[model samples]
Target: MDFKVREVVPHGRNYALLRMMPVKGEMPEVEPGQFVQVEIPNSKSTYLRRPISINWADRREMWLLVRRAGAGTNALCDLPEGSRLSIILPLGRGFDLSVRGNVLLVGGGVGTAPLLMLGKRLVTLGVDVKFLLGARTTSDLLQLELFKQTGETRVTTEDGSMGHRGLVTDHPLLTDGEIDHIACCGPLPMMKAVAAIARSRGISCEVSLENMMACGIGACLCCVEDTVDAGNVCVCKEGPVFNIKRLKW
Candidate 1:
């Protein structure tokens, strides 16, 4: 689908929060934790569309939190309002919303993007939601105010610039609360550690993987993840989100 940029709000030196709307119709239904493949404009070296998580979506607009990690994302962040973008959206599976009881959503760095929508939906469903966010420093944490509005929010920064002075896995909430479910998205090491903690406690956990991808469709086979059930499965199709048990981690 084609979308037009409505606004570009830069979060820091490396991140931009883009608000967009469809060129011709109302926004389609998008599950939280699903992502979009954005075609980079005016970039010669970038071939594949960049995959970005759906930060939030409403009836008329969609938001993408993009990090300027490379040439493609840099170009995407620099796009002006009113620019047109080609996108394949709402791709990949998302976190399970059927969960109930006390739920914790954990994120690190740019991984915090998708949790905003997830928390909002969970709140509407009357599910108790809390967020545990971590970053290298306070500046690395994005959308704290918005996250707080959706649920109880906590923070951990390696630099100790905010909240707790350690990694999120070290947060007291993880060990202290009556957590019924955990959904996490972050660097592999962070997610793995969080999964381990969840495993040891016998709490249900799900994680979103950030595997490399060429095509956003299963046909490309570039984003295959080794899973316990299906061997090598495409993360773009089978999931970007998976239960910890299904993962070979």
Candidate 2:
């Protein structure tokens, strides 16, 4: 679907919130843990559409929380309202909402984007949701109030600028008691560490990979990850999200 940029709101120092509405057709179904490939217009240097995680989406609008980490994202952040961009959305399978119990959603830095919709989805289904967001400092944390609307929220910062003064894996909640499951998206190291903790406690875990992607679809095998079942699978299709049990690490 082609989406028109409705708003571009900056968040803190490094991130921006982009809100877009479908230009012609109805908005495609968007799921948490799924992403959209955004066409960056007027850029001769960058050819492939950038794959951005779907932050949150409603029937009429789609939200993407973009982190200005490179040239591609910088161009996206500079896009003005009323600009149009082509988007391929709701790709790949989202988190399994079937398992019901206290569930924790963990995100690091801008990785928190997809979890917003995931949290909202879980809340809509009446599941208990807890969010553990980590950043370098408090200023790096994005959209806390929004997450709070759906579930309990917590934070961790390396600089101790807010909440717990340590890594998210060090948060007492993970070891405090029984949590039925965990869904995490973030830096590779953080996701791996969180997965390790979940595995040790025998809690099922799902992780969203942020592997570099050129084509958002499976055709371009650039974003492949070595999995236990499948030797090398495209993270763009087989998953931006996958069960930890299916992963080698």
Candidate 3:
């Protein structure tokens, strides 16, 4: 599907939120947890199709919260309004909205983008969902108001500058056994921590990973992850999200 570059809203010093204007208002035909492979025009070799988390999608417009951390994102930031970009969207499987009990959603950095969308979907589906956004500093915590609009939102900054004064794992939710189901996306250590917490409580958990990919499809076989049953599975094809129990990590 074709997605038009509608508007770019700068988030922080390094991040910008992109709004995609859908042709015929047919946006959001995809799941909340899905993603789009976007290619900005005139991007040099350093810039190319980048995988952006599907922040939120609807019939008219879709938003992507992207951090200008690298050449690709930097090039994307230069795109002007009304500029058109090519996109292969709503691709890949999303989180399984299976049982709807109390759900714990944990996110770190840009990984939090998709989790926010997931939280919205769960809320719309009438599933109890709570979010815990974690970052090294307050400056790194983006989209506080957006996350607040979804459901219960909490933050944990490594520094005492904001929200909680330690790692998000320090949040009481992880230790209280209050989360019926756990879903996490973040740095490897953070996700691993959440996984361990879930394991200790015997609660099933799922994780969305940010792996390198040469091809968005499985042909390149670049984004492979070691799984319990399937020795290696493409993160883009098999999943960007995987059950904790089945993952080798």
Most accurate candidate by TM-score: 1
Worst 10 contiguous positions by lDDT, candidate 3: 40-49
Worst 10 residues of 1 by lDDT: 169-178
* Per-candidate alpha-carbon RMSD to the true structure: 0.7, 1.0, 1.5
- TM-scores for all candidates: the values are 0.99, 0.97, 0.95
Model 1: residue 230 alpha-carbon error in angstroms: 1.0
* Model 2 regions lying over 4 Å from their true place: none
Collision pairs in model 2:
none
List model 3 lDDT by residue over 22-93, tens digit each: 665577576756777888678666554788878888778888988887888887776788878788777677
Q: How close is candidate 2 to the true structure, as a TM-score?
A: 0.97
Give the local distance difference test score of model 1: 0.94
Query: How displaced is residue 71 in candidate 3, in Å?
Result: 0.6
> Which structure is stronger by TM-score: 1 or 2?
1
- lDDT for model 3: 0.83
After superposing all C-alphas onto the true structure, candidate 2 shows an RMSD in angstroms of 1.0
Score residue 149 of candidate 2 by CA lDDT.
Answer: 79
| Number of the top-ranking candidate, with lDDT as the measure | 1
